[model samples]
Target: MLGKTASDNRVFVYEVAGVRQNTDNDKNSYPFRSSSSVFIKVPYQRMNDEMRRITRMGGTILSIKPWTSNNGSGEQSNDGD
Candidate 1:
């Protein structure tokens, strides 16, 4: 299970399956600042489906990265978002 914390201190869980850098930096500065790692967050249940899609698209699943908040306790409320 995942825990929630403050906005800045919140850890984002993502999968670094594959990445494509934007080389068209000359067109805009957005590409340069955004041309690092790609983090996509999906629900836990959808992980399997996402993995299948990535594999089908010829991308390799690197690893499952889970980030836990430092200040967050191991308690999460399921009151619906």
Candidate 2:
């Protein structure tokens, strides 16, 4: 098996919605408030796991994009947009 290298440390951002405040999310200090959506940082190694977890929590995965540093914010880099 090809071992992961430093170059494979890419991170992606997942924009999810419909994750309501529930018993599962009550442990979070900043619990989900009534909102349209939220952005979650997911590492390359944890994409599938995060997806499954989000699905189990009744959250819909809206968009998944490679995360890039925009100044100090982690966002999708789009030159044209």
State the TM-score for model 2.
0.74
CA error at residue 25 for candidate 2, angstroms = 0.8
Tens digits of per-residue lDDT for model 1 on 39-58?
A: 44445555666556446544
User: TM-score per candidate, in order?
Assistant: 0.39, 0.74
Cα lDDT tens digits for candidate 2, 2-73: 998974778788888897766766776553566778777778777888888778779999999877776246
lDDT of 2 at 23: 74
Worst 10 residues of 1 by lDDT: 72-81
Give the runs in model 2 whose Cα sits over 4 Å from its true position: 1-7, 71-81
**Candidate 1 residue spans exceeding 4 A from truth:** 1-12, 17-37, 67-81
Whole-structure CA lDDT of model 2? 0.72
